[model samples]
Target chain A: EPEVTQTPSHQVTQMGQEVILRCVPISNHLYFYWYRQILGQKVEFLVSFYNNEISEKSEIFDDQFSVERPDGSNFTLKIRSTKLEDSAMYFCASRPPGLATFTGELFFGEGSRLTVL
Target chain B: EDQVTQSPEALRLQEGESSSLNCSYTVSGLRGLFWYRQDPGKGPEFLFTLYSAGEEKEKERLKATLTKKESFLHITAPKPEDSATYLCAVLVAGGGADGLTFGKGTHLIIQP
Candidate 1:
């Protein structure tokens, strides 16, 4: 089955450095999202995108965070000036546009582990 | 804010053991409740989605039930491969936020 794919399985960066995490959602999927999981914690929503624009975002998705679909097949999340607390496993997910059989499914990528030093 | 609480924090079961995991939730309005499985260092894998009260769905060795207030994931004759952290999330209706509010998750260990 086709699955979401993310790049840079793991990344380590200085506290003040910038980081960009990339993802390619399933070919037929239309809704894209970014979520993060701090070590041993819950998965928290960051943002959702559709129609090539941001649909919604959470408080955690502050000014430091930004997402873009720079190309037809790529979705990217950039973190400006990472902090120690920014370290976490960031996941990219997508779902096909709502249809008769839709029951709220979000397919996810393997995730990118970010470690801030 | 939407909230989801899963219990107990962890569970350990011997092979072929049957058990149930609980997911309690509070949302402004229910859109759907979702279940996912996560292995260490991996993103969550979607398992099931229950859209309304009294609805149920099943997969091999797994059955999920939903209610107005909570949901349950029952595992029958489970194998070690079934071991993983199970997460439950909620999507609120009319919230304009398609993002999910996830529970901390229940970590299950099935020993063969």
Candidate 2:
């Protein structure tokens, strides 16, 4: 089965440095998303992207955060300045067409663990 | 706000044992309910999607049922490989753009 793939399985960055996480969603998928899970915590939605634009975002996805589909296959999330609280596992997901509702099933990547110090 | 609450934060079952995990939600308009399994240091793996109340889906030894206010994931004759954290999430009608509102998840351990 085809699956979502993310790069840099793990990353360590300084508190004020920039960090970017990359994902390559399923080739035919139309909707892409970014979510984060703090250690031992529930997964939290960050943002959703479709048609090269942001569909929605959460409070956690403030000005410091940005997402880009620079190419047909790559979806990237960039954080301008990392903070200690930003340490978490960032996951990328994609949804294929055909579901009646926008809330279709999602395929998630293994995730990228970000550690900010 | 959409919220999901999964009950019995943790559970342990002996091989061949059967049990259920519960996920209750409060949302404005229900679009879909989803179940996912997650292993340590990995992303969630989608299991099933319940679109409306009274809908149910099954896979192997696992069965998922949905009602108006809650959903249940039943594991029958479970084995050690069934051990993992089960996450339940809700997608409200107009809340699709924000993605899923996930619960804290239920940690299940099946011992062989």
Candidate 3:
């Protein structure tokens, strides 16, 4: 089965440095999303993209965060400057649009673990 | 505000043992509920979707049931491979993009 894939399975960065997490969602999927899981915490939604634009974002997705689909298959999330709290596993997901009823079956990538020190 | 709460943060069962994990939530407008499994160091894999109250779905050894306020994931005669964190999430149609709100997961350990 085709699956979403992410690059840099693990990333380590300085507290004030920048980091960009990349993902390649399933080719045919139309909607893309980003979510994060802090160690020992629930996975939290960051943002969603469709039609090459941001559809929605959470409070955690503040000015420091940005997402881009620079190419047909790549979806990336960039954090201007990392913080200790930024340490977490970031996952990318995608899904087809317009199902008769919403089921919430978002396909996810393996995830990129980010460690900030 | 929407909130999701899962009970029994962790569970350990011997192989072939059966048990259920609970996921409860409060959403402004409940559109659907989802169940996922995540192994250590991997992303969540979709397992089942419950769209409304009284709906149920199953696959292999796993069965999911939903009610207005909560959902349950029952694992029957589970094997060691069935051990993983079971996550539950709810989608709110009238809310933000993707419309998802998740609860902390229930970590299940099946020992062979």
Candidate 4:
């Protein structure tokens, strides 16, 4: 089965540095999303992208965060000036549009673990 | 804010034992409730999505049921491979995009 893929399985960065996590969603899916899980916490939604623009974002998605699908196939999340609190496991996900399927199942990638020192 | 609460933070059961996991939520409008399984160092794998109060779905030894304010994931005759953190999430109606609000998750361990 086709699955979403992510790069830099683990990334260690210093405070005030920049880091970009990349993901390649399923080939045919249109809607894409970014979520993060802090150590021992629930998964939190960061943002959703479609049609080359952001549809919605959570409060946690601050000015320091941004997402792009620059190449149509690659979706990237850039965190500017990482902080200690920014250390977490970031996951990329995707789902198809429309109501054709009975369940709107979303597929997720293995996730990129970001550790800020 | 849409919120979800799952009961029994951790559970350890012998293989072939049966039990149920609970997910309670408070949301503005419910689009759907979803159940996922996550292992260490991996992302969540989809399990079931219950769209309405009376809707239920089953796969293998897992069964999920939904209601207005809560949902339950039942595991019957479980095995050691069934050990994982079970996560429950919700899609709110007229909420931000298709983002899902998730619960803290219940960590389950099945031992032989």
* Model 4: DockQ vs. true structure: 0.70
Worst 10 residues of 1 chain A by lDDT: A97-106
Taken over the whole model, the C-alpha lDDT of each candidate is 0.93, 0.93, 0.92, 0.93
Model 3 clashing residue pairs (backbone): none
Indicate the TM-score of model 1. Answer: 0.96
Model 4, residue B11: C-alpha shift (Å): 0.6
Provide the TM-score of chain A alone for each candidate, in the order shown: 0.96, 0.97, 0.96, 0.95
Q: How many Å off is the CA of B98 in candidate 4? A: 0.7
Fraction of the true interface contacts (Cα pairs closer than 8 Å across chains) found in each model: 0.87, 0.70, 0.80, 0.74
What TM-score does model 4 achieve against the real structure?
0.97
Question: Which lDDT tens digits does candidate 1 get at residues B8-98?
Answer: 9999999999999999998889888999999987889999999989999999999999988999999999999999999999988774768
TM-score of chain B, per candidate?
A: 0.97, 0.96, 0.95, 0.97
Model 2 per-residue lDDT tens digits across residues B22-49: 9999999888899999998889998999
* lDDT minimum window of 10 residues, candidate 3 chain B: B92-101
User: Order of all candidates by DockQ, from best down to worst?
Assistant: 1, 3, 2, 4
- Residue A18 displacement in candidate 3 (angstroms): 1.3
Quote the positional error of residue B16 for candidate 3 in Å: 1.6
lDDT of 3 by residue, A1-117 (tens): 999999899999999999999999999998999999999999999999989999999899999999999998899999999999999999999997777565688999999999999
Q: After superposition, which runs of candidate 4 have C-alpha atoms over 4 Å from their true positions? A: A100-104
After the best TM-score superposition of candidate 3, give how far the Cα of residue B89 lies from its true spot, in angstroms: 0.4
TM-score of each: 0.96, 0.96, 0.96, 0.97
Q: Please count the clashing residue pairs in each candidate, in the order shown.
A: 0, 0, 0, 0
